[model samples]
Target: MVALSNVRFGKRNDEVKAIQAGLIAVGMNIPAGATGFFGEQTRSAYAAWQRVLGFTGSAADGFPGCSSLAELGARAGFVVDCRNPGAITKSSVRFSRNSGVAVDEATARAFAEQACDRTGAPRSWVTGVSNGANLLTLVFRESSFRPNAVNRDDVNATGPIQSDGARLNCSRGYAQVIPDTFAENHQAGTSDRIYDPVANIAAAINYIWRRYGDISRVQQANPHRDPAPY
Candidate 1:
């Protein structure tokens, strides 16, 4: 980390000089007689390159401070790692043309279809078919649709109920639960679906009776996870 830090600030070091050279080679628009300081001008150029690749972050100073730039570079076929601090970053796009996510249109369609099947949602509601499809997002974002990823360990939760970090307690998977006492009381119904995407999806649609379902309670039973009464 320190080695790269020095490389970023050197005035006469050729390696540092080389970095500035590459930045200029790609049209950095530096000031006249640039002294290899890796200053604002160079940062602007780096930031511009990052934007071209759809990264989301700022380029302040010249350190590439563990921001969106590193991740952007990584996603754009670069082995760039933010944790490494300063190191020689290489772009995968430069050497290997056959890189990037492997998912293709056909496969994505199949995956979407499978996701819909698992959710038991109408085939017409699937993407490219449904008017407002949300099954895929629910599976991927909230639960990863994998029972193993339920995140049973994350206990320091601020939200009412969380299925790990993805599915907020109030907002159930795919359903986007509303935060309310009644909503929280309904969480028990989802325990069975802790890892079953299909079951979880079905539970969301049931939206069992809320206001009228349990009027004899201190507050409305947790509506999102209300347990059945004996």
Candidate 2:
């Protein structure tokens, strides 16, 4: 799901149209048929839905928060939970990650081989010779370090400001990939799961291959040219 707007009464925007559609789909009486405008009727229906969801007073003041938008989206046949690593396929949701998902030995080997082949990195190093294993081990260690592990949330994460003085929010996923180097590099999934091991590893490998070309290049680069803030 894309980022939802935090909309309330008196605001008129394109996001309001999605909200109106969701409200109407959930059986709300949006008589104007999803007008981009937020009027009294939209507010009343939204408040009533909020009350039904057990919120009262200010909490039910017809303002749409993330949770409320998610619930509304669910009712409208959309899956809005960013944490769910699942796909809409074959008329059912297929979960991509399970309790045991991780950077197993096989996955690491295949990833390294692919990276070496794609980037023309030395076969020995890409196959975990010298400091190559260290890179692979970092992902493994991070994925094993927490209960959520690879599913760790990277949304709203911040890294130390970069040399260019941009307060980069590029750290993400099990490999903690910084993906600003490529255009439209995001995987086809929810935004928050940029940290999921499968997605993170793929994105990180691609970023490394694209940005630094090969591990040897990264090793030879000036230390002061580090892109990572940490």
Candidate 3:
């Protein structure tokens, strides 16, 4: 285990840098110019990591406890509970993609709720179609980066829709917001903020809602596509 000292804003140490590196390695967004100093930016990034790991409220406070440090260090996959962060299930979206292992029902439900909340779809709609719809995000996520990452080559890309014929100049974060989508839907920010999980998910849901209306419609439109079982 990497021994890390308790850190808060204003501390400067290699451990702080290590923490930043760990979080970044796991797809959390630390500033590109992040120095070894623990500042508000680092704390905010840390909190975002906690949120992904299913921590919320006081538990989501931007502090690095031993467990959080270990989680960062381990680089194990984490699941975000849309119900709340209080009940996190450790599942790997990467593993499911790479190994063809299906995500568990709980994770599917979480994704269903999260997606529905943004689209104003009924919980039952997602639950009914969660088996297939969840896979779209999971499989599509394979082509996506963490909220902080972008394809180096595609950084300058601008397109409204992602397609094979056109260069896929858009895709980042969990939901993979393409350039055109970002221009139309994003709140206003470029670079790292576009990769923010909340921002990306919101943009993704918005895109999906605008295109498909609801989860059931999404399934209807893409009947042959299959990523996992419900």
Candidate 4:
């Protein structure tokens, strides 16, 4: 079985190798031949497979979605696990309010860039704002670039307060993720603390990838759209 989480871009592991083998088996050309590294060649091949599977536009953009990856695995004789243990229902989170001092745009961009790097998401998400899709905009809307921001009145506010003075499950940090969300989606090498800017943003990015497939599809990440729960 292959976990969908290990099949993203920039990942290097046995699962990526298995995915490459599957793609190659399906007549997608991966010249490196199951190298266990997911680079441009593998992404291009995966995108081709997506096209073969009738996905178009951004849906065929090489980032593996559960359905597409699972189909590939089915053909390759491997089971795909699409479960996201970190996922929390939108009903459990409320975009109540932001609390904490706001940081400047430059600082927020820097943090977001670091998060993109950690999560293997495109840095363009932070550096560029095409089609109103921008990570900075999402951070600004969620917490106004506040690294320590907390939303205390939401449904997730039931736990005892922590060192940051907010309840344990209250949304916190630049992306305002709850502690459980942060713990489940935390990047491998990042600080465990939810208040850490890069860690928080990275977890949010991973969660976005798992839930929405891409940041552009998230309403909160698009400046032109009304702020919505993601």
Candidate 5:
């Protein structure tokens, strides 16, 4: 499963090395420095980054994944031009519109599509739901999802779908995944497990299925309370 490919697969050989170097510079990673080969050491380094950041799920393998890059970019404030990506921090949306990194709607949609496709969810629905909204890639922003891959960068995390960096983990891509008590309840279908994005997306669709069956019930159940600020 870790062998899957995304845009990150097309990174130039030097870009791959730069990622390793950046991870190492932050002191939480020690991959062979992106020898242009995504091997175990790189994977371990990524896992280390997750652990440092306190991501909830498994460690990040050194496959040069977009989620990893996007999260790190968010942490580093790529879009907005911030500095330093710790496991957690007290920065605002660091990513700026000027960051050399790409931050366009089309890119966001592609990433969201990739996430949906991999999770086996309906890309059409996900895209429709997130359309035109401020979107960002969910990378290592979630503490619950970051612990295993944080390396030694002294990164920190808040809770599920929580972070204090660039808001790029906006409500768009997989990074914006939100799981509530209702999600947990509906997950009884052996679908979209909240913890696993793949399962969560599937579960999300199933969760929305209630609209036809019991949608009104769901809306009535959870009061419209604004989520806590990140």
Candidate 6:
């Protein structure tokens, strides 16, 4: 079985090779063939596959979504594990406005871009569901760009006090995620500390991908819409 996380852009692994093989099996051209690297050639081939699957415009931009990737895995005799550990019922998560010491927009954008790189999300230039700008907006709405922001009065604010002087379950960091959410969606190779800007943003991005499909669907991430719980 191939994990969906391993099949995105910038990722290089056996799962990428499997995806390349699948693309080849379906007659998509890859000059380098199954190189295990998800570069321009693999992206183009995947775009072709996406087109064949009836996706167009931004959907066929070669970035793998769970449904499309799963379909490819099925056609290639493999199973895709699209399981999302960050899956949480929206109703169970209450929203509250919280703020802390703020950073400039440029610093926040830099952190958000790092998160995009780690999570296979596109930067601002890419037109798609979730991009770096979307993440920046979400982070701003959630914590006002504060990496150490914490919401101690929200519904998730129960539990023992943590090292950061907040309850263990309080929404913390730039993305305002509770401890459980952070732990569940934490990106590999990132710090376990919930206050780390890049790690917090990456976890939030992964959670967004699983829960809402993309940041575009999140009201807080949309500039024109009134900020709401995501």
Candidate of highest lDDT:
4
Q: Top model by TM-score, which number? A: 4
Taking every candidate in turn, the Cα RMSD to the unseen true structure, in Å, is: 22.9, 18.5, 18.2, 5.2, 18.4, 6.3
TM-score of every candidate relative to the true structure: 0.25, 0.33, 0.34, 0.72, 0.28, 0.63
Residue 89, candidate 1: C-alpha displacement in angstroms: 23
Residues 22-79, candidate 1: write the lDDT tens digits.
Answer: 5556555566434556555655665565565455532232334334334433443333
lDDT of 2 at 5: 24
lDDT of 5 at 94: 23
Residues 1-230 of candidate 6: C-alpha lDDT, one tens digit per residue: 88876676667899999999999998999999999999989989988988999988766777677888889988998899876544443323333323453586788888788888877777751223443337767788898877778898988889776555777678888888876787777777776667778778888888776655446556778776788888
Over the stretch 1-230, how does candidate 5's per-residue lDDT look in tens digits? 01112113223354445555656765755634657544556656766776666643423333333355556555543422111111122232122111232434454455445544543334543333222211121232322232112212222222334432322223322233333422332333232322333333333333333221111222221224222212
C-alpha lDDT of candidate 2 relative to the true structure:
0.49
Off by over 4 Å in 5: 1-12, 57-67, 74-230
* lDDT rank order: 4, 6, 2, 3, 5, 1
Q: Write the per-residue lDDT of candidate 4 for residues 27-97, one digit (tens) a residue.
A: 99998799999898998999999999998987887888889999999999899987654444433333333
User: Model 2 residue 155 lDDT?
Assistant: 62
Candidate 6 vs. truth: CA RMSD?
6.3
Give me the overall lDDT of model 3.
Answer: 0.48
> Model 2 residue 70 lDDT?
75
How high is the lDDT of residue 109 in model 4?
85
Model 5: lowest-lDDT 10 consecutive positions:
81-90
Task: Check candidate 2 and list the clashing pairs.
Answer: 173-195
Better of 1 and 4 by TM-score: 4
Model 4, which residues run further than 4 Å from truth?
A: 1-3, 9-17, 20-62, 79-102
| Of 3 and 4, the candidate ranking higher by lDDT | 4
Per-candidate clashes, comma-separated = 18, 1, 3, 0, 45, 0
**Tens-digit lDDT track for model 3 on 1-230?**
24332243456776677777777877778766458887778878888888888878645656655566567776743321112111112220111111222345444345436654543344554434533454235424443323334443555455433322333454554555554564444432212244444445545544543443334434332335544211
Q: All models: lDDT? A: 0.35, 0.49, 0.48, 0.80, 0.35, 0.75
Ranked by lDDT, the better of candidates 4 and 5 is 4
